[model samples]
Target chain A: MDTAAQPDTAPAENLSAKVYADLKMKLIVGQLRPAETLSIRTLAEEYGVSAMPVREALRQLASEDSLIGAAKKAYRVPDLTPSEAANLFFIRAILEGAAAEIAAENVRAKDIKFLEKLVQDMDTAWQNQDAVQFLLVNFKFHSRIYSLTGNSALQSMIESLYARTGPWLAHGITELVTIDSWMGDHPAIIGALRNRDAALARKLVEEDARWGVDLYRARS
Target chain B: MDTAAQPDTAPAENLSAKVYADLKMKLIVGQLRPAETLSIRTLAEEYGVSAMPVREALRQLASEDSLIGAAKKAYRVPDLTPSEAANLFFIRAILEGAAAEIAAENVRAKDIKFLEKLVQDMDTAWQNQDAVQFLLVNFKFHSRIYSLTGNSALQSMIESLYARTGPWLAHGITELVTIDSWMGDHPAIIGALRNRDAALARKLVEEDARWGVDLYRARS
Candidate 1:
């Protein structure tokens, strides 16, 4: 008799998942800021799709801590507290330092060549003020080193951590008109790897990462 | 008129999610073996729910790589390929080893006491042949150490890795029955913490993990 009161009616199929993906990419690329509220309907109309996929994508992003979901509230991008930021940097230092060490120990000649080429690509992109291409090449360069560690899980965990920091790092890249000195660090890191000096490689990566974090914080 | 051929006319809000959670816990506890598959309808009936939750749960589990899913096909538990296992252990060694170091520096006297008591609880459960309780306490004990690290991201990554190996570890625990030796390792780890020797603490944790991995592999 009370079947009409059922609250678990099935949800409609989502059509806005594409919007969600695009929005997520934008968020990761610093096109959106922390605490930004992405209105579902606005996105749906803009993407020319219904709101369902957007809602689903938002749910998944919330699980990744990229978005915050609260009771009776629309989702918003997560804000990093000072303490969380400090802790994130600590975790990154350990994992990335270890990654650099492993990569140097196992870096093949081919991998080093790829990294050098990628760094060159970064310089070209920097001159062109092509933020998107610069960001893409930067990701590939770091990832090539990580994958050389030959530890898929470590590679994955590092990637996840980096993805969470994408917005900050992307912003840093965009504001820097010419990253000549920053680009200089890449070759030094690669040179250390080529010399098979694991410790030196690790140090360079940690220094590079620390410098990036500091620069981003100061800019913010 | 041709929309009938489209997949997912709408998102299904079903009870399969609850089924998935229940099954996942059992799988983590070693009730399910690698390559095992259960009929969806059968599991639904056994869990006293409709098939929807089971479907949703399987999809979620598949995303975690704990279960393998194919569209309109039966889901199967993923086998722990040797390389995958090795990769998981490697990441765990790094993260948990660092956690022990952090825990040693940060854990309170009361936390040490709490850990010691949990070790005793492990002894009691092992004596009573209560495999379930033994597993539960062991998980809690390690989790307590992670909490002491105070890095939520590190803790979360470590737990996901733990879950991936849950079934295998449970089987190892049941057959190996070297509970005393395993429980014995915790005190040495705690002792290092008590002394605030972070390096020593990290070393002990790494040794403790290596021992477990060795045991698990021997059984295999």
Candidate 2:
């Protein structure tokens, strides 16, 4: 008997979707290595589910360009050549830079306070070397900033890009924990926004982003 | 037979997606009236498809936000409330205006000639009052300009926003077709860019977009 055909024995219908989401998260968080081949059947077996959901999940991930799929074939984590990685970085810089600028004029006092709390939380997570907590808080921090514009479309665009870049968030936070001055930039960014200094806030955010690229280059 | 189980085979899906795409094209070209609620099952049956596809198609349309899903889950053509419309206009002006400035330095001579040919095509489309053709060419015109940036991310961002504001595209183009002076702006924009005047090109593009919003409002 094919164990993969079993449906009600597990949440099989939704399992693929969940698996896809998990892998996508791991990819963005850098848990999964690039060019890693993830087998559908193996994943289904490991998760104690059927392959149908896994298939659908992979399809959606492929749509986001998180996974490479040969037509009518298997899937694997995409490996970017140096040039492709550079292109992605440049695009991220321009888009995120613009988003941060737009966000500066619209962020509220409460959001600033929330960000301050986020930094405090990150500090705790960093000291403890708690990767999961750091990642979650970082996601919240950026989402909150993106939400300031109240443009769902903008938020979705950012989310899609973040999804494609998978697993970079955790790596970013880990880097932050290592460099003492790194975390200082966030507060400065928030301060500029709080003061209604749009240009200054935008400059700070871009500078912060530039620093991250430099760090990534040094590390990677 | 309930016919609900095999919803995939039902014609609603076929009809609805077709209607959705058709209506979307019309809206994007300014042929369909805004504030319209295209009937659901009626359209499904009319198109010889089942309601499932229609329902899914409408939901998909909502995903791109070309159509708004409202109270009680009815899908309707989106109407740009004054403030929301203003916000959309300004965002486009800021983003696309910036894009033109960026593209000016990089735009090739061959691309400018292609743009001139596009303008001539628009003249023919305008003469025929071919709203669809005009819209198609208009899309090509702006897209060709957008392509000059060689930034997929930025192009994608602008396209996403453009899709969301599909209704405005149709309305804006239709009105521009009536006023001959509207089409003249494109050449002047190309002229400014050819002169390598990034600032002039940027200003012209900004003015052109603002002029569109004004024309759209005048129609209302």
Candidate 3:
């Protein structure tokens, strides 16, 4: 499913899918701001592709509720209210916590080592105050563990959740809290995973994911 | 979001949206078969619409992973492997359990009465051995409680999970087990809610949701 390694196909179709994937990632990583309007012409120009594919991708994401669209109008990233934001993190806490519990059951020494490296890198990104890099690396850190669960559907659902939070997190961290505060829970989570304590891992991950609600509250 | 009451739009769009909504409901209620390939021509004829709108709806559902699609081919419902099916139910256990806990906090006397009515209706459906009606009413029974949480995102996530399970469940209940086994847990769940015992509600709901895995196993 990595577009880079996939075989070639019709140019237009590929461009639309590529744009969709790229935009989904950007939305997940907070590359775009919440409530920001996305003009097809602007995105096409930005990606150096035609407007048609950008439009298609926007429609697709809108259907997923990650964006707001209307007939012949530009798409806008959905802006969550404080309560809506809290509800989202609440659901994430349950889903991702369950994911962590499953991941702990499947953890291996090498997997722990890999997670450790990502944690260290996340710390480095935090120390350097590279919010965007920190966000992307933080994504990889969690994705590694979710992948261990061997449930693509769970991983996909979790990923779609980021599309709603990414913009808010990307913006909230800059003004409300340091990246380290959010990163603080990662080490303990890794420890629980290393010990193969599924219950503890679930608890810690739930604790870690609860920061999203706090972030939303602080911003409000 | 209810399509029936909305003012009509362009005929093409109305048809497409109606098809999409209808298909989504059918999938949720186990009216479709897992891994069953759906022909656009046949569906268009079934719905008495043009193939173009049917094709568009199929593409939309396929994007959502309720159906699988390839260019110039019919879309097939995803047939999950046993492990994959178990994982789906595992995630649901967490999500729905969380929903029930929250619903307990928000439950009113009238809400309990409403839920009791649903439980009775589900029992009636079981007495009639109406697998399809049982599935549909069970959806409403769970949905009534989940709606109490006022978390649209959680409800949406739970609903999407149904799309993946419905076809299999519909098939399984008809052949593997009767509807009563699954209905056994509902009354206790209602009691937990009536008592406003959040923890008990969560535990009971988790226990109920875990039935999906058992259902899948019996068939396998």
Q: Quote each prediction's TM-score.
A: 0.81, 0.73, 0.88
Q: How do the residues B1-220 of candidate 1 rate in per-residue lDDT, one tens digit apiece?
A: 1111112113233344345445655665556777788677777777677765565555545545667666557888767766677667777778889999889889898999998998898889888987656666766777799889888888867766665676666667777855456766888888888899999888877776666477667766
Ranking by lDDT: 3, 1, 2
Kindly report which residue stretches of model 3 are placed more than 4 angstroms away from their true locations once superposed: A1-14, A40-56, A70-73, A177-179, B1-16, B41-56, B177-179
iRMSD, model 3, in Å: 2.7
Stretches of candidate 2 exceeding 4 Å from the true structure: A1-33, A36-61, A64-70, A81-102, A130-132, A168-181, B1-62, B67-77, B172-181
Structure candidate 1, residue pairs in collision: A13-B10, A14-A52, A14-A53, B15-B53, B16-B52, B16-B53, B16-B54, B17-B53
Model 1 alpha-carbon miss at residue A168, Å = 2.4
Q: Scored by Cα lDDT, where does model 2 land?
A: 0.65
Please tell me which predicted candidate would have the highest lDDT against the true structure. Answer: 3
Pick the DockQ winner: 3
> Candidate 3 chain A — worst ten consecutive residues by lDDT sum?
A1-10
**Residue A107 displacement in candidate 2 (angstroms):** 3.6
lDDT of 2 by residue, B1-220 (tens): 1121112222222344355555445555555557777666876776677875566556545545667775456677778776566656665676677778888999899989998998999889889987667766766677788778776656655664555565666666655545776787889988987888999888888787676567667777
lDDT of 2 by residue, A1-220 (tens): 1222112113222354356556655665566566778787887777677876566566556644667777546688777654445545555555456667778889887889999999998789767887756555655676687678766655655665565554444455565535666688888878877887877766776675465456567666
